[model samples]
Target: MKKNLFVFLLFSCFLTHSQTIRKYSNEFMNIGVDAAAMGMSNAAVANTNDVNACYWNPAGLIGLEDSQAALMHASYFANIAQYDYVAFAKPIDDESAWGMSLIRFGVDDILNTTQLIDANGTIDYNRISKFSTADYGMTFSYARKLKLPGFQYGVNTKVIRRIIGNFASSWGFGFDVGFQFEKNDWHFGLMLRDITTTYNVWNINEDEFNSIKGAVAGQNQDLPQSTEITLPKAQLGLSKKFEFHNETSLLASGNLNMQFSKTNDIFATDVVSIDPALGFEYGYTDLVFLRAGVGNFQTVTQIDNSKKIGFQPNIGLGFKYRGIQVDYALTDLGNQSAALYSNIFSLKVDLSIFR
Candidate 1:
């Protein structure tokens, strides 16, 4: 019993440190959506031109030839977590576009061991229960072309919802803006996520609080702060396509992501950190595509106390026919990066197909 008590004390101490809102809040939204983008290590911001653009860069929606819908599903951490996405977009008068998207990331069927030991010190298997923790994001997007040729801009109003069974829940709202420009055969894009500094107001269930309040050292332990903040971030990208032969083409893109703090990123400074990514797609007759990318550079300390650079490489395949598209990407292949390897798949359909 002494050993268990010691472990509990350590765990409580860790919890106390993380009780308040801090960096990386609402991070599930950053996991990203759309297999095509992830396949290219999320470097498609400048060239995304479908329903999926609603999540990547809504400005790209102006390039959609028809109304579109997309669906994606991915399992991570050996199936312990599930990520799902859906989106729809429609162009208006060939001058603007509107869209909506939903994303859900969750871990289900988790055993609630907190109640396993009763007040009488009686342990019963039947006392164990199951619950799930999930995060959801819904976004409404609109885009319009400017008077300047090849210039388009977009905006997003998004809502974030997070739940931890009956323990805690939060709701947040945020705004994002994106822009796309084409000049002299070059495509440039900018995406500002959480531009307004997203905030989540949390509500803790005191009834659930009673269960673990005693785990800490004192009964005077206070409830955690109820407000969480997500800092703003941005991505800048450039892309271009080259055509060769009768039915062969290649698309190359690169992105630089910026954050406000110093970190392990390859290019980190006191005021900001920048992570760069590169992606390429080779298309055959516009029907099949092969994609590749590399990104997420960081300095890692080896077991031997040596520092070295580490990066993630991603590859993907795509096929499209009759206004339908299927894309597949294996991010973090072979655990080369900190993230677990997962197979991502997404499907896109032209709503006109039903006509």
Candidate 2:
């Protein structure tokens, strides 16, 4: 009982400290495809079936009773696409489990351009360049149902890499740690990700070098330099769920994704932003499921009274066949005024190898 109290207090502290800082960074890599399919409302972290759970909340692997694997693909705005997630988890005894996962994001067919001056002011045309830019990561995870009453814990270690044409590539490492508790029909969860202070170390080449250097060539400039960018601020999230019946549940989850740096400033001060989400799911014999969710992050951050930051909605559906599961989701991105508004369509395949 005393240990349980300590754990609760620790979680409370995490929430308090988490609230004090707010910022979002490298948000592109942080967006989880599976979560997006569910309207990004995954605070309770109940994704034990899909391999993408390795990216969502590794602790969720505790719910897997058999070896399972899955794959997910998505197309973002500007013809950029991503392929993510394959994982296998096997139970060891009844209390412990281990898993491995691979996540890859590929953006192909990007047009490369060079400036040409031929009477018509400055014209830009296709120059010699490669087909895509990509980022990939590998993760190893371990999860256990703790003996401590009402508590479960899990952790993951990841190696991350980014490749931007042949001119730039970066590598980094990070980890995620999480805890969850359940009693009766109520569930609560907490997770902290990117705790290693991961940063992308860029290796820039000559063409890229000359572009920056030429712009400021008149001034004394460093011939060549290496720079690093921190991925995203470490984040802590809290979620809760209440099941009204065997087949129906209502979920309310929220996250404070802090951004320690901003795009304009390489070393900007930290800022805190709040993202709250609500979702509902209905199940029929655990075979067919319908879900809808809505969330917004920019609502609280926008300074202009006329400028709306976040005002989007999300909806999805799922089906189960034998032991295989498939899911789809749609997320709204306000309007064209938002610049690069996105409509994400994702497919996930979950297969259980052993039951």
Candidate 3:
């Protein structure tokens, strides 16, 4: 019992310290959606020109040749988490388009360890409860080409909701704006996420606090809290396509992401966070694709009193026939073990097929 108590104290301390590095709520909105984007290290903002563009850069939606729909699913953290995404886009005319997208991320069958006790005055393993936590978002977007010909701009209005079983929940609203310029074989894109600094209002009622107070007796407890602000973020992308032979081309893309807001979480002392990623896709006659990327760089303290940047790699394969596209991607989780990776699959349908 003493050993267990000691371990619990240590874990509590770690949690307190880790908050410094963590950011505000609805982080799932930042996770990349489609397999092609993840397979390419999320560097497709400038190069995305399909239905999925609504999730990346809405400006890219103007490039969709027809009404399109895309669906994506992935298992993260060894299947402990599930992510699903869907998007639809329809070009209104020659120079304008509108779209909508839905995103869902969840963890199911989580053991509610706080209620593990039984009335017999002893721990009852079977008495432990299970619950699921889910995050969801819906976005509507509009994009139009500029009179400048190669330049385009877009905006997205987002509604976000998060739920933790029947205990607590939050509602948030935000907006995104993006610009894209495409000429010849080169593309440039910029996106401002949560441009208005999304605000999430959490409602933690008395009943919710009472439900867990018994298990959290001491250890620096605080009253139920409400409200958190998500800071704005920026992303810049540049991509170029090099055509070699009969419709075969190689596309190289790079992205730079930065956070401008400060977090109460103390994980890092820096006022801003910057991450860069690079990706490449080789397309064969626009039928098959081979993709790879490297990014997720972070400085880590080494055992030898040295600091080094860590890199995570990703690879993906894709096939497109007629109006149907299938894509698969595997992202390295930096664990070195092959089994410890993110698996993603995506399917896209071009509604023009019906025409």
| 17-45 per-residue lDDT for model 3 (tens digits) | 22322354567898888888888989988
Ranking by lDDT, best first?
1, 3, 2
TM-score of each: 0.93, 0.73, 0.87
lDDT of 2 at 55: 66
Cα error of candidate 1 at position 116, Å: 1.3
- What's the lDDT of the predicted structure labeled candidate 2? 0.55
Q: Please list all clashing residue pairs in model 2, or write none if there are none.
A: 22-271, 22-272, 23-258, 23-259, 23-271, 24-259
lDDT of 3: 0.80
lDDT of 1 at 169: 79
Residues 256-306 of candidate 2: C-alpha lDDT, one tens digit per residue: 444544422222344633455556665666677667665544432245645
Top candidate by lDDT: 1
lDDT of 1 by residue, 1-355 (tens): 4324633543343243234656577878888888888888999889888898899898998998889999999998889999999999999868999999999998888666666667787887687777777899999999999999999999999999887777777889999999999998799999999999888888877787667565444653577677877889999999999999889998999999888888888898989999899999999998999999988888778999998888889999999999999999999866777777889999999989999
**Model 1: CA > 4 A from native:** 1-21, 215-220
Misplaced by over 4 Å in model 2 are 1-25, 35-37, 44-50, 115-127, 211-225, 229-271, 300-309, 333-355
Report the number of the highest-TM-score candidate: 1
